[model samples]
Target: MEVTPRLTWNEEKSLQKLLGNVSLRLLYKSSVHGNSFGTMLNKCSCQGSTILMVYLPNNVFGIFVLESYPEMSEHLKKPTTSFLLSFQKNKIMEMTAAFFNSTVDLIDNKLRFNFSQVQYVLLRSNTQNIFIPRLLGEKLGLTYDFKSQYTEYEVFRVEGMKDEPGYINRIAGATPHRDSLLAELRAYRPYADLVSEIRILLLGPVGSGKSSFFNSVKSIFRGHLTRQAIVGSDISTITEKYRIYSIKDEKDGKSLPFMLCDSMGLNEKDGVGLCVDDIPHILKGCMPDRYQFNQKPITPKHPTFITSPSLNHRIHCVAYVFDINSIDNLSFQMLAKVKQVQKEVLKCGVSQVALLTKVNNCNGVLQDNFLQMSESMIYKSQVRDVNMMLGIPKSNILVVENYASEREMDPLQDILILSALKQMTRAADDFLEDLPLETDAIAGMFQLCMRCQLPGSRHLAQTGIADSLFETLLPFMFCLLSLRASN
Candidate 1:
């Protein structure tokens, strides 16, 4: 019989590094599954160094071998001849020859150990219990070739995405609703239409799909797929300048009421991304459009800075774009940066949303049925994870399949893009109504700054109770002053 590579390669309960160049087959497991030892023997035409793995309800595990057993039924009736090797951590802990069904005695009397209280290791595992070296494979009457390799393979029958016919059909049915979704979004007038357009600032780590998001939205309204913004696969920021992209209604050719402003991708390198101090300035419309970013911070004194800008020039909403597949790969420092940036967004009193891109690449069912994109388990998990990481609401986080390579317009793709746009506009409207609350936001930032100046908030909160000694000696200074005056 051939060794099952997948079963033997399991590392949960077995040390696979010890299985170097060994013929390992999972012969038998007590009650989990697979053939019995007796049944397996009948199927094997040739045999030598046959190993038996015995597992019981207790934590004890055993390995016994018959050097030369002509028939499988012979051992069932009289099981006393073969030697048993008990091992763990790739070391021979004990070796004993079985006398009968219930007992075993150590082969070496010098080393004494107790098997009397030991019971079976009833854990379920896929790892093999027997290992026969390749040199011994031929000597054991096994004629199978040990060396065979192939570079190309096929997985035509492999297990994969569950087929949900009902859900899939619903997605197909929703294909025609793209126009309606787009119409509803276009009807939405921004709460604070600054300069007749609601400006949304795009923010995310490099490769987090910030640029691609602008391109996807532009493509949707363009009535054909378009790549207005540069998108790349590299980890560095492809967007060098801060630019604003406006969309027009496809049917009426009227300018859309909203615009997406993209910035240099957020970078982890020191002094690479948008500066912390520049955030407040940008929200207030101090930075002008199409200005290339540099490490140095710009103030209102800069040549391109828009001084004393009105509400039309300011950002009304913020969208944090993240790649669904790359959330786990992001470093901790990047997460801290994201939180810091969110604090700035909260202080600006602007509504925020999260866009998770590359949904098709994450799940096959969604790739096959575009309408079933939201129903995918992977998409739902990514949404939940992004929510937990940045504290975005579950409903506000949108899953979108970007127009990366598709040359033509896809209704399903447009539907998702329009849905996200609608939410952004709605959130922007809510922000305009509460714009006066910006003072409270500023106060919160000041409070945080004060706390950070302290040695530590955690220590300060608990320090009062721990300072009884200082409180006890407080009268000594006043008594010393009184004595000096008398002198």
Candidate 2:
């Protein structure tokens, strides 16, 4: 069998550089009710290199093949693979969003990882030159040719495309009820026993004391401090890498299982970091190739990239940390960044909350002035006339005074923890609601594709576009109804 071109050492290193430290672990579940696609790939064997397969049958299928150049494998540590096919602009956007949302889910669930994990991906298609590469290349302006002159092509099918076993699908293949889930999530009680995770992104410029605030929170958990601690410092020591904290609730002031993620403080150069600037690239690094696609867009057919099942749909809420006493008066600018993050969070149905750090030492006059500025911001940033944006109530923006005084810290800690838990509880409901909706969305999309009628629509129809559409979709719809009733 002929294989696709693999990236040279420099090329693979460049792609890996974009991924940062994140890695993924690929797990192929047993075949579900059917193995139509699984069977086909199983039979095809690569002549020179092992092809990494990311398959979510009835949902999406992606292929990752090693390039022909073995010279590239002699990188510093271990060599990496490059994606074979490219995607279009729109498809790239869709898949990139999927990767971000899904990675959050996986990380929240605490999955395993390896250094030589599946990095690059390919979307398997019947034809060599599909729409995947063209769309992706156009979006990033990368040079790509699906029919790469350096690589040879071969057709291989699994022995029994229909008889494959041991492929189990996720969640019984049902559509989730988004609107209903949203409504139910709104009613989530803060004290309800929820066994879910919360993703707290602390974003701010350097010198905002983001690290101090996080350490203060840790101190509270460690019992070294009884009050809600807020650290006021001039600079931060955090350089790179994400710091994770596990928080829990206990009767003796020991609630374990709390996770705090201290991301690298944002600066000018970080604006374009692959993780921050190219959201898709970071997510793709976290995702397995099995969930990717190789098909590119062509005449008469709309090419949309798909992704694998995500860990969760919604982020509980975002906490924006701002220095309240900055001599430069950075509140307004901080508000703008918060708004930007709020918009991104809304995409996955999450809410945003503003955190005012270093409030204890602020003079009375500055306090009043800061409050007024914040209120004005709330007015401008407010999503709707009724109250909040994306179904979040306006009362959710939390302003706590983080001071070093033990006397002042007790109440602040209580209030902050309560607010954080409340926000997280609501987010969990939103996350659950989000998953089913995503599945239903894919089903709905495929249904639209099935109804599409162009000159050669019949030929496209034979690609299992319709049957695969229904198999995954109908179940999703049924599950949504069942969930609604239960709610």
For 322-377, candidate 2 gives per-residue lDDT tens digits of 55455245445444554454555565554455555555421121122122223333
lDDT of each: 0.56, 0.34
Give per-residue lDDT, candidate 2, residue 74: 34
Lowest summed lDDT across 10 adjacent residues in model 2 is found at: 166-175
- For all predicted structures, in order, the TM-scores are 0.53, 0.35
Best by lDDT: 1
Off by over 4 Å in 2: 1-195, 226-239, 249-258, 268-275, 278-309, 312-314, 331-340, 361-394, 403-409, 427-487
Best by TM-score: 1
